[model samples]
Target chain A: MDSVNPSSKYKDTLSLIIFIVVVLTAPLWGKFIGAGYPDLLQKFAIFGLFAIGYNILFGLTGYLSFGHAVFLGIGSYTAAWSFKLLTMNPVPAVIFAVLLSGIFAAAIGYVSLKRTGIYFAILTLAFAQMGYNLAYSVLTPITNGETGLRVLRDDPRVLDNALGVQIDGSPVGNFFGIEMTGYSGYYFCAIMLILGFYLAMRVFRSPFGMKLIAIKSNQTRMEYTGYNPRPYLLAAFVISGMYAGLAGALMVIVDPLAGAERMQWTASGEVVLMTILGGVGTLIGPLIGAVVIKYFENIFSAINESGLHATFSFLPEWLENIAVTIVSPFVGDGWHMTLGVLFMIVIIFMPGGIMEAIRRLTAWVKRMRG
Target chain B: MEDNYVLEISGVNKTFGGLKALSDINLKVKQGTTHAIIGPNGAGKSTLLNTCIAKLVPDSGSIMFAGQDLTDGMTPHGINQLGVSRVFQTPEIFPELSLLNNVMIPALAKRDGAFKFDLFKWLRNENQLQDEAMHYLDDLGLADSSDIRAGSLSRGDKRRLEMAMCLIQHPKLLLLDEPTAGMARHDTNRTIELLKKIKEGGMTKIIIEHDMHVVFSLADHISVLAQGAIIAEGKPDDIKGHPKVREAYLGTAEL
Candidate 1:
């Protein structure tokens, strides 16, 4: 009918390859050069999945949610219950996590999407806060309050008992016979992260995804064009919520506990920080954001005065002391200060986040080479 | 009555806090003709268009389009489904998307109703809709800019892309709200030529325009509105020298 245009499938394939290579080598990166990665690396993959999910809703659709953590919490709680009631197998837990979280998200998104902009954000936040409070106080029978719902030795795990309790000391989440703990746990999460990224990529390129982004760009335009975005938005909300739940289940599979603290408003805010900090709309940006924040939080904060001294030992004593004094605030108990400064600097200089900064840097280097 | 007229507005009244944006306005566009509503500023041309498109509900009136009573809380989406496509005055579009994407969305909306889960469906699988959208884009002379971001287009091009988006639906009734506003002469002429080409297709057109040149050249019938009411209604030649129409335009004394 009309004319022609170029396509972008090849670029997507290349990016997918790069993503797989980098994530598959997570255990071999820098300080993680040992046989088994510290639990922190698992945190990277887990929260990375969560942030990717959040990006689908907020970044792709422009639905800024202040309560996505509730999906993760619901997932965590559901996984814990599955372990205690039905089985200790990670498969059942992951499936249940996604299913229950999706149902809950649908119910909440239906109500929240009635209003848009700040009001939508507030509605989701209120729903999440209510869920958190219930888990902390009212729903203690199910959530088990602050200590959270954990599997005990006496839990009537029907599936496990039916198969006969062959393992020692309570139960461990397993896939067939392989335990989901230590190195295996990291491996499990890494695989899930890769799969999640692939699915997210598909969504980004799909017609449905285009509709969501259209709604984000101009809802009024979309309406006049004969597209009602409500059902599509609700679907995206549920899908992303399922991703959060999957991450939650993975967390429990790795650590075997779900706490009320996991559902707090701060937790929701943390995922928001990760999504925006990496790059609001870029595919790989949320993962990078998750890594940066987790690295600062779990690893950098552990750097003590002696650790700082070792790093700056080559300097003269006066300069070394000064370096330690300055660096110390950015590490240990004051780690959040480093993050705060980073957030401010990134917002001021690169409002598009780290991904934009990286893009510019690469372009500059390319120019220099030319 | 149903066979002759495509849009019928009866007893429509809309008041914005005593401003009386539109009051008791009644108009009918015969099937397959280009009808223009020409009015001075503040004469409620835009307001009446908004009410017809369901962007604003008339305080009291019935909008009947394609045998559907559209006055009962019908949404814009609902109105659009009845084969009514509106070209806004300001050229509203999905600015962040590619020109191809901007066109494809309307095609898909026509094929897939208001919403479809369609989450896993590959973009490549939408070959039919894509081809249709490309046809419209090419028709509008925007095939070369198909891959460019819609927001990056010039004002004229953006308006053209918006028309391509609306045209894909093959709407039975097209409501254009000042389609040639703020355009260079070349673009305005190009638009008029495009409209002339579309006129052959026999879709009823309702154009609310301030540009008398466009109104006289393209419109088969013209209605002159002022102070929230139609001051004159006749063929373009008849309306040109109508006494009340001249009075409204030049604010001449009754004598």
Candidate 2:
């Protein structure tokens, strides 16, 4: 393990500048583009936050937690409840969601961190399943059972009532003189994503983060160094869980519905795919991966075989039929299968994910230049 | 000599099911001196180091460090916080981390306590830790490779880097397991010279070694173990002449 040098400092600064520029322009691009695209972008941003958070633990510490969706689900459920019961203000809802998720993560992490490697992952998966079951069966009144929780129109916003006008079904809550919907909602999620990204970047550079890498490399050596691996693992797990919570809260803010499916194992698996696809341990890779996967899910899933056939009409009839037949399995209902194949290809051929491939290409180019 | 005895072990016994790995091992390590523990295979040299560092709990024994009773089931982190650090037989550096971050980790752990939740703070701005890491890396001739990933280093360089990592904590006691086990003769000599420099810098070290050259060149005190029991303990020259030590080595020729 080495420390940051002056040269890498310049690279870091340049990357940060590029990141800021892209973030600043994302909303502008979103506003000008198709409405559905912006929504997809928002989903991408939220899931990116989720995946980045997951990577902090899984990527850094080498703990492959299988129950991370519990945190996200908890965040969504808590945020929805806060909005429906306490207030409609998104800030409080997000804060409540994060706090609740953090507490949940801490408790689960405490028990799970007692085990290492596969056992720790199993513990997390079991806890997540427990949470999922609870949300479906026992927590029916709060979670609203299979139908899930929705923000009712009659939910009282005391702050709005104090102003003497009933603001029912209106997305017009002024938070410090700013609307909390539309552009405001997007900005809110984007800001949170940025903050989460920044925090993760800091952790990547920190000494504690180095300890995590060491623990990942060799647990026995870490023990001999006088460091207990459990606490560090637990802390990473909680931090990652909290990030998932924030993502869940953002999910509800973008669309105020908390479904039981949000906490499902598949949801957890999706984030794992995103992290691995993007490049685990690389700061920007998860976000890019999240965008790519969500883009395919939303856009590719909508394109039917007929639609593809019509689009490719310029080709010869028989060739177009063959192309459509070949491509049909990759679109619509087969999108997940396509993703699975893509994941396998990337894993086998480009084990470091897209970022590493790009890094290697750039290094190769530099060598050629030399 | 009173303050110099940083590590005191007595009646330390470790058993795995029906077999005893270590029995009644008593030892004292003086500050800034290199104390070497040598034994043939299965002599429990690794087990003793593990017990001292709290990786494995001794069944019945006491380990005292700097006036603190560390044998009361403290965690490895707890013992590390008490100013003790160890290096493995193989290089255990973080393969992905830069060399500087590796050294900085233990240094920060030593300075900032075992665990910290400074989530919102930037760690690189902690000038004190950066300075200390740099100082240690410079001492071990690894400052030039501070930015390189530790796994990319040559074997000799990796060993030096690991040493730098252990030293950065300014530990009162350092435990090294086979510091020259897999090195070439030149690399072993380099490691010996590094150990000599470390000792000259007033760092107390306990080394578990098989290479007699490294042991003889660096150890001020030597302890010989045979079949999990210490058979000889004295100055290096005295242990070298012990018939029991010779017999133990001769009996374990297959090792």
Candidate 3:
């Protein structure tokens, strides 16, 4: 019988330690690989947060919601509005985004979960598309449509000014008077990632998490056993939505601009891809998936024909031409093609994703040692 | 005895579109007695049990369990919370979860109904809840497979695990739909024995079965049905000799 996770009691603690070590020292390790820029690290942590929260619903509860981006876009828009109306501090933006997204998720999840399986997915997808359309048009005053919402200079930042923090200087997101930029911004996002990880871990081991897993396993049995699966599933959805909210808010904090395009169905689809690639039911898989996919988006797409030519310079002209031609279509403007192939391979060969592969490899090594 | 009936259904009628699934059904299952419902296929035995848990709403009449209405708009979980739990014809244990979790779930549900926010609380690795779950598995002879996935178990073992899952809820009334369906004689005998043990503990059981051997062995009271309506209702001995019950359901063909 295939096991869900490590049976050892210390497994949770060990995984937590490993998670903390990797995330805290991410910049140093990332610098070693020339991917250490604060922007990229911040994006990695933010999206990692989004994916973990998402795993709580889709992975744990077997609910594949195609509308998670509604919460994310709302979170981003809320941050922008906060900066425009109230303050440039990231705290309020993060809090407001999480809260609003949670409320939105509760409302959407309540209606969407009326049906199950593909119907549920379609319902969530329809709601998200509706949210996107609204943000793109009807709610243009708040959302600013395609132009998006942005912070303005000399605007009345009520809280900041009341605390005598003058707006005479260039406006920037701050962490209690400290500027949110470069390393500081990345570290703040990383801090949230840690908190998010802790909360996710708690939820996973908790009885609520068990109920979600049980729902996925057999909802019929649960129903006859005196268990109401509706509210528990909604709770997971709301909590996961808040994670997306935090991710969206943090994105604005690092780079202050909210775009209507953030709510697109494709954006929601990316987190689903990330969770699946990293390992759906495990703790660390979603973050690993988020970072990898984002890495491919940033670094792989930037690889040009020239960069390929430079790397393959030692090869014969014909060989180099063949190599570049074969790889070119999978890189640069075709990074998504590479991602699609990777997703297919993972689905076919390792249905449990990369984490399961790693587990199998370690078990093999252990067997060899024994 | 009538006043102490654990489950009482009066003037119940149910239909699907135009086809009558059940009609003019009145049943009173005495407390601490194992009542077996024997019927032909489509005789509405499953439908009758479904109403007890409110899975299907009766067109007319009331399903009263322990003096509380079990029908109308009440959900299945709501009825189960009123100390009624059901086992499906096929085992419905959590397939992906370990056998321990399969049993632990109902135990937890019995302790904390529907929803609980025990986040940050360790749920696995030998807590009191798991201990109680372990006890159920041990009682149902599934102790050796506690760590195994419930899905991987053989059909008989899965049935036993499902029984363990339902039993852990400590439900006052147990509803079994074809409790020993599609099992070998050995497995069927084991299930009958398990039910007998449970009955000895003073739990009221409502079993639906087509197998007369199981019905005669475990049922203290029996109800025989044909064409969605009860034809005979009596003790197992009286039901065995009833000419209508034998002619309608248990023909010499099955005997």
Candidate 4:
């Protein structure tokens, strides 16, 4: 077995506590940023969980998988089916989503992992694209095509029926009679995010994680060191896929919809951006990345010309108009442009991402203090 | 089935297109001995070592390492797990990891087999393994710099780090492909001393070296190769005096 210094163990515990406090208090702090809404908060937790898992494979093993969304899609579909056929409860839905997505991830990973580098990435991308097409077209019966898979009022929820749970209206995801909606949903997802983050931390500090880093640093050296890289890579891929599945399951748990678009390549690309934007290899980087991207997509994209105009009202009328015109392309539907520019800046200046910037800032502070 | 030889390579032949890399190469490395293979560039020294580690599959012939047939579809890690390890010419250490991690990783691999899930176990709790890793770092005179990234080390230090990596595994057959490829005179001498220290442990080593001084100092037995075939094999002094070796390898340069 491999071992680290004891001081780091204390550091890990401290970081976990800080992380828990921050996540649990998101709604309170979120109010100041105009992001106190339960739906957006729920998204932050869900995507944060997704990115944390992606970091395991992409961050540690350096396997750039462009097909993770398939697992997410699989998770959503599995959860929706569980809701429709089995129960209205989130527990069984989440379990089925994780297991099914893990199986899919295993099969896909086994095929894609045969090739490394760009080929491996392309292979994963191809598998996800294929899955998206199937879910949209041929597999429409199960996936429900463009309509998406959701629990219907008339669908037989055998478990709920057997448990004598009363459903007066449309089915809502419930945890023992407590509806998974609004604050309850956000808290549920937040708890999962915290658990996922803890698991990711465990992976980062574990010996297996060290080997994964070793694989990233020098795969040839790792093989020569008597380690078979395939098993490790596959395990990471499956673990991350399960994470994506959990996130997908949570998406339905909050709203109960499974769309083929969730499996699209762009969705896959989003998680990749989230991982890179936060910090590729660092723990908590992916969550920050996910939150940042989701924040931009939700909050920043909602900004309109009037909002920009209001902010720039202090300027002269013509200058305010010009400022709004210049900034308009970077907000609303064009928020991607802002994200693109931010990504470029981060890549060029702080290639390690926001976490790296934070690290450097702290280091600078320490240097000044000394 | 079992003999004093730790490694027995017989009638091994490897070819790339029409070119023969190793043609009917036959050599036996005894247990607890430092055997050196000295040859000019492209003389199949690295090729033979790669074949031994299953990096390159030979077109023909068999390599038996302590009753295990290496040529019979054994993977590199499988060979390594069977106490066979190799040091590359470029010093293949995990560049981004700390020097201590560079040492500890192989030790973990050796102890934990090819794969183990130990996801929740704290690496800080593995006190014995960490101590052993620290001891090896101390052995290589790198204890003070164990926390530094392996990539930031100088070329000679990287070589020493690689040696520490291999040594911690305590491999029965350690194949080194030019262990002192790019080093100053003093660094080369220091590596020779390190190898000599390990030689006291009675671990078998096959060193492929270009430097005559390193080969002569450490190798109890020497094999001279020219054009993918062994021209001479004997005690180090006898290998130095061989006419074919002097002409093919030395090329009129006095050793």
Candidate 5:
């Protein structure tokens, strides 16, 4: 029961250095090899933010939320509405999205946190489905129905008007002189992703975070020690929701559309899958999973059956077609089948996820070096 | 009636369905004394201890600690904040977290209220918190095993670590549920010595024990329970010689 020594300060500094390197170099790599697929990389970074936030609740608290996509959808819809009605400035729109998501999360968390384990997961899923149904039918007027909402050239921007600029098609009206497209948009999300990572790291190291772990470990003991665990659990849920909101806002900023599909339970399940694939609870694991999954979805899906056959033409014709047929289901719309198989394998063989496997490998290497 | 009496339980009754787990259990322990509750099997010793600490609510009872009516509605976190801590019969340390972190939890909660949302604050840089935790671990002779997982500890070591966790909170009342329930004789002796040292160091403790030798050696006041009622209460010698106590325990053997 001795005091644990502080983890090496250099460990954090080193991680920061590595993060900076990756953020700076990734877009450049995308530019060189992705063949006009910078959007793919940007989308990966945005979803990486979402997955990281989702992991805060799922990985750390040992609570699996199946409706996290509702927060993401709410954030996107709120930001879209803000841009359409109030202002076209991305700053306030993003802030409003995050705040709205926080309020939404608080409401869901307060109700859902009364139950634990599978019940809690079902409650969250039920809420998310309710949100999805509302967006699709009940709230069609505000949410613009299944067709979603869009910003037009005539949309009023009071701030832009007050600043003596034209309301429509003006180059001077960019967000702090950086256009919300291409590299600038990618950088904006990349910066926010780093900040989100920093905040999550802080929570991981905080006493409140430890209390969440305590609740996860022995909730009965936590109660006996005089803690009402509901508040802590709710707080974690809300913070995670805000993270989802930021990612959602970034999505609308990059492409000014918010659809009901974003709120679907499948999106929620995708984030969970990403987190588990990369390593739930590890700092960079979810981000890695997000990038990997999005990369497959965006780039790998473009490789159709004919594309596979063209690449494998050096082999015998029968062998080439057989190889193409064998791999066809995993290339295009069937990519999800491959993802499902990969997830099952990971769950069975590496239950701790890829991050844990990496950690074990690193420990073994260190032992050998020593 | 002493000002420093750490715990005061009056008219505490607990009924589980049709059975009375505890009934009208009134007890008080002065500061810096080792109070022991002993009883035959099913005597409600554990239930009484649980009720005092708000683990189980009594149907019609009040528990006062440090001059406050810490009755049925207060939670365990609420009681811990009022300077009361408990060690369970089974080792309840965080199995995955290192022993150091397990002890740090209660210590942190004691220092930083019942709840704080300081998600960005660094726990390691909290110098005062680390110092206090280290002091308790040093006293418990667990300084060497601080980084090891608490679940991996020997039974005797886990008990010591659990005690250390409770002690670090600087509780006014320490409730131990069978501190030596499943230990070897040597380990039991060591636990008795630890309790003795804790009492000498000015911490009030209430121990629920079945071991008569340990009870007689340490208790300043003894309460014997039988079938959910306090059948005898006195000095250890008086309870040992009481005819009813013999009948409850020895069952026809002459004392």
Candidate 6:
């Protein structure tokens, strides 16, 4: 209905193609920035999917959930247990993760959605905290407690054992005998991210997406306009949860571990930061946000005193020392501080997130060319 | 007898704590007629509209719209799906969306019912709905700025956009709550014109108005409320000269 300009649909297709190309070739370009490693690249793909899913709920419906990490944790746990009991095939694990987490989201969303605005946020947060604590203690038998749930040799991989498959090494995620590790793992996650991005794009362009945006803009108006906002909101919540679940499933697929720490409030907050930083409501914004944050966590945090010194080695001895001291806290273990500052800058200046900045830049460039 | 009326409120009573917001109120709006509810501030005119839309529940009464009871635990959206569309006192448009999208949303709601998981159905594919929305926008004189965000429009434009939003739904009944609340005389007349145009479609309309200009021009019948109860009910001419109605407004001053 918003297709006033005829070429907008064409633009969307072009954007999707560009997004696919960029994501698929991440490792190639990632090498340029010292992020070529499969583990870190896989993190990019996985978290990108997570943030994209989170955007569907928060960015679309404006129901800022503070507990999506619980879904992620649930997915991880489900997939890990699937490996232990059902099979090592990544397909079933992914399916179970998505289904279980969607159910959890439906239950939690039904309750949490009863209240809107800040109350909704607090309710979701409380439910997530309850989930985290339960997993850490009361649900220890299922979750495997502090050690986290891991695929074990002694456990029955029903399908694998049924096929007379032997245990190879430390019980990694095997997809039809092909190891889901290294570059293969990154590609698998990348493929998922691409598919997820496409689905999100479809949602964004669909009438359902318009309804979600309408709910976000004015939920009261939406209700009066002859639409039930509750179901739409719950649907968005469940869809987003499934996305987080898929992300979690991918996490354990690459690493084969489900930890209680993944469900923490901080992890939930991190996705929020990613969505806001990338540009809420825009399709690729969340992915950009996810990659930036993950990149900071993996690469920026690894910058030690020596690395800083090496970068500033051209400066005089005293100047280099001063520079190192000034920047040290923002790098390495204090990387989150740098992230906080970046978040502030994005919120203060580019409230629409990095996507807004890019839009502004392009508009300015067009004006200059004119 | 009940089949003759499009909307019937029988002995509806609503109280906000100790304040009797509405008491023993009964209104019957006939099919294909414009019924106006006029009252001084705090007379529960809006509250009545709220009840009609299921936004507010009458403490003890039945609001029957087209043979269905609105008070029987029906949600606002469900009542809307029953062909009841309203323009609120202050225009309730989706501010962040384009005017076109704002209009299309209600149309989608009407066509798709209250809830449909049409997630994959692209909006671009709904060419017919888009054309209809554009037609309504053009009717309301908002087509020129249809691409602009609804929030950026002037108050009068926003009101008109909200009208287009409702008009696109082609609802069986339309409720206008002070559709010209804070508009200039120029814009007010324009809104009156738009309301009159929609009236040709013979949709049953219940309008709550303070402006007698709007009331006289659009209303076929009128109900006057004073202190949460109807003081007069008749044709427009009868309501215009009713002593109780004049006193309700001018407070004992003979006109």
- Tens digits of per-residue lDDT, candidate 6, B1-255, equal 767799999999999999998989989999989999988899989998998888888889998887789998999898989999999889999988898889899999989898999988878889899899999999887788878889999887888888888888888999999989888898899888878877897888999988888888999999988788998999988877788888886465432
Q: What is the TM-score of chain B alone in each candidate?
A: 0.95, 0.91, 0.96, 0.97, 0.91, 0.96
Point to the candidate with the largest lDDT. Answer: 4
On DockQ, the candidate that comes out on top is 4
Which candidate tops TM-score? 4
DockQ, candidate 5, vs. native dimer: 0.63
Model 5 stretches astray by more than 4 angstroms: A1-5, A31-36, A167-173, A311-322, A367-370, B2-5, B250-255
Give the runs in model 4 whose Cα sits over 4 Å from its true position. A1-7, A309-322
What is candidate 3's lDDT per residue for B1-255, written digit by digit as tens?
568888889999998989988899999989899999998899999999988887788999998887788886888888888899888888888998889888888888889877787677767643787888888888777898788788999887888888898898888999888878777888888888889899899999999988888888999899987888999999988987889988988887454
Relative to the true structure, how large is the alpha-carbon lDDT of every model?
A: 0.87, 0.81, 0.88, 0.91, 0.82, 0.90
lDDT for each residue of candidate 2 in B1-255, tens digit (9 for 90 to 100): 567688889999988998889989999988788899998889999999888877788899899997777778688788888888888777877776778877876776776776666655556677878788888888777888887778898876787788888887778888998887667787788778878987888999999988777888999999998888998999987986777877877354432
Question: How does model 2 score by TM-score?
Answer: 0.90
Native-vs-model 1 lDDT?
Answer: 0.87
- lDDT by residue (B1-255, candidate 4, tens digit) is 348899999999999899988999999999999999998999999899989988899999999997889989998888999999888988899888898889989999999998899898877778898899999998888999988889999988898899999999999989998888887887788888889989999999999988888888899999988889998999998987888888899887767
Per residue, candidate 4 scores C-alpha lDDT tens digits across A115-156 of: 999999999999999999999899989999999987888888
lDDT of 5 by residue, A138-172 (tens): 89987888799776677676666666655546321
lDDT, candidate 3, equals: 0.88
What's the DockQ for every one of the candidates?
A: 0.70, 0.46, 0.74, 0.76, 0.63, 0.72
How would the candidate models be sorted by lDDT, starting from the highest? Answer: 4, 6, 3, 1, 5, 2
Error of 2 at A44 (Å): 1.9
Which interface RMSD does candidate 2 score? 2.7
TM-score, chain A only, candidate 5, equals: 0.93
Pitting candidate 4 against candidate 6, the one with the higher TM-score is 4
